[model samples]
Target: MSSVDATPIGAGAKARGAGGRRPIGLLLVAAPVALVLGLIIWPVALSVFDTLTVHGPQGLEFSLEAYRFFFTDGFSLRNLWLTIRVAAICTVLLLVISLPIALYLRFSETRLAGYIQALALFPLFVPSILLAYALIRTLGPNGTVDTLLVAAGLPKMPTPYLTPWGPIIGLVWDNLPLTLLIVLAGLANVSRASIEAARDVGAGSLTILWHIILPRIRGTLLVAASFVILGLFSAFTLPYLLGPAAPEMMGPFMRRTIIEVDDPVQARTQAVVTFALCAVFALFYVRSVARSRREQTS
Candidate 1:
């Protein structure tokens, strides 16, 4: 009688099992992927095609006139520059403001941490339009702040309401919750044992943060920066309500081009250009995430 082999299943069998499940995973994701392709990818492709072509005597001739106008026009260049500047400033501010709050919440055992987090995330529940209106009421001319300043016999201070700083302030406030959350998520990877060990080795809080915490959370910081920059680039409501009329951010600039200037092609060009800029940061974020995963796995 031949004895039956009692060997356990090998790697090859495991591989076959995984391969069998691949189709099921793909099927699960197929619907959302199809929706993204239909809703986002198709519209974007059409916009790009529109920006690169024009209706001529020959009917739908290829042209770069829209892009040429964007690159050469002074007003368009100014708007683009203003958008970049505001987004950069807001990204920096978000990182600066969120990191400390995240650090405190990550290490503190106090009861107030929950309340502080709630307050920080309060803007998430408030509608952007309502926030813009509230900002206008509180920071606009003769609003709450100005009223209080006048009541105290202090000279009226310069408000950010209609200046470039307006959008910067609003964007920073609106994005703080997300930035803090990302940083906190990153902080979770920092083991208490490592921190305690560093403290035992005479490492101060600042030293531990610089040497250990910041290094571990660097990827998270990059992700937050990329997200903030992308959101600010495409932001409309706050910028529209708070920002200056001239040299508008790309969001308002695009809308004005379409509505007031009645140039859909030019507006599409602006959008494509904005998307290209955001894509660069998006690529950086992707690379950072990939590197982080590789490090974790290895």
Candidate 2:
């Protein structure tokens, strides 16, 4: 009787279970996937294509002229070097400022902690243009900072912030909140148990931080640094607002080619270079994440 009743019921049950998956799952995901491919992936692919072609008043010509021009262009090396320097300095400054705040928030129970965090994040709400204007008021000649410096017997002390260094300061200020938030999130995941155990075993605060906390949050730090680097590369508003008359950034270069020169091809070429830089960073970030995961797993 049992043999007669056996009819591969489990196979049919599995088939029904597979068929019951909500179709909305695919629809929900497909739209975003398609949109990204269409808007971002396709345009990036097209920009690379555009960079390979030469443009004239007459029409487009397929050539290596764009790539050739990039190498021989004025300030190509100088401006590129400046951009990297700005990004590197900003990343380092941001990490230095943010990591301490993040650590404080993680370990301290001060009554003002939440307020301090809120203030830190409040800068994010301020527009870059407004921030630049404010900085100009505070640090410009005859401004509050300069006024205070003169009153403090430090006349002829030019505000280093008025030069390219000024823009870097603004970049750091603008980027600090986001980096702090990310680092704090990573810090929160650190094991209090481990910290306490270290303390119990006669480890000093510095030793515990060096031995455990930094290693645990190294991935977060790398990710934050990557974001800052990419943001600096793509950023235009802050740099343009704060920069001197001869502002030099990849963004301004792209803008000039597109808007002033009426040459989309050159703009596309600059964009391709920026994309390549970002791609290198992205590959590094992916590898860093993979290494972190392997370490955690092992």
Candidate 3:
């Protein structure tokens, strides 16, 4: 201590310590980032490679053979069509149901609106697999729903389980929360003054909805639709359990091709195709968000 070098040794030591720790800090940050990139990038790369390569006459070569086989042989086309059909129908039905609920929540001070909201959001907490099984138990043929119907002297309706409508029903229930939340958020941004002015001029409810509400909520609609479409395109669990064997959705088709048909390369190629379709909608969703942000800032 008496000899201390008398040159602000403590400050210099602290500076050197911080400099040493800098690389450690950087490593801590980079490690997770590297892991995430490795997880996402590697599988995607493998899928693309599988999609573009074929065991051709030359042992291995790049070609569109996989894609041609998928499209022309109608293996992928049928699944793609079914996926689109279910997704489209669910989207339309959700919009039809969610719109009035949103409008009611916007204007009403009633407790019923609160209960409706709680019920609508209930499915968010239920896992899809559990819900799938629960639906089969409650609504399947000879299950609780049919029993009740028969007891009431009404014939039991056809079992929706293991049918297209079965998955459709489950998907609609699961997707309701998504669509409702979007519609409510869009409704929140609507100017109360404009709505009031329209009402003061004797504009009917449907007219106000058409001329005022619909235009403002267009972006929200796009966001909701994109989310639903993306989800349905990759739908696995619900449709897998409830849907029929023949006209399967893309998710089941992909898995069946891998496990049953023993075609990992083809399955991965199908996955690549599904993701590419989702990408188009994802780009539109991004653009819609960017435009909404710009409008708000401007």
- For each of the candidates, give the backbone clash count: 0, 0, 0
Model 3: which residue pairs collide?
none
Q: Which stretches of model 2 miss by more than 4 angstroms? A: 1-21, 55-62, 288-298
Evaluated with TM-score, which candidate comes out highest?
1
Task: Tell me each candidate's TM-score.
Answer: 0.90, 0.85, 0.85
Ranking by lDDT: 1, 3, 2
Query: lDDT of all the models against the reference?
Result: 0.86, 0.77, 0.83
Query: CA shift at 295, candidate 1, in angstroms?
Result: 2.1
lDDT of 1: 0.86
Report the C-alpha lDDT of model 3 over 1-298, residue by residue, as the tens digit. 1111212223344445556656765565465557767997787998898789878787879899888888887757888888889989988888889888877877778999888888988999999999999999998989999999999999998999988999999999998887787778778877889999999999998999999989988888887788788888888999999998868999999999999999988898788888888999888787887787678669
CA shift at 289, candidate 1, in angstroms?
1.7
Model 3 scores a TM of 0.85
lDDT at 150, model 3 = 92
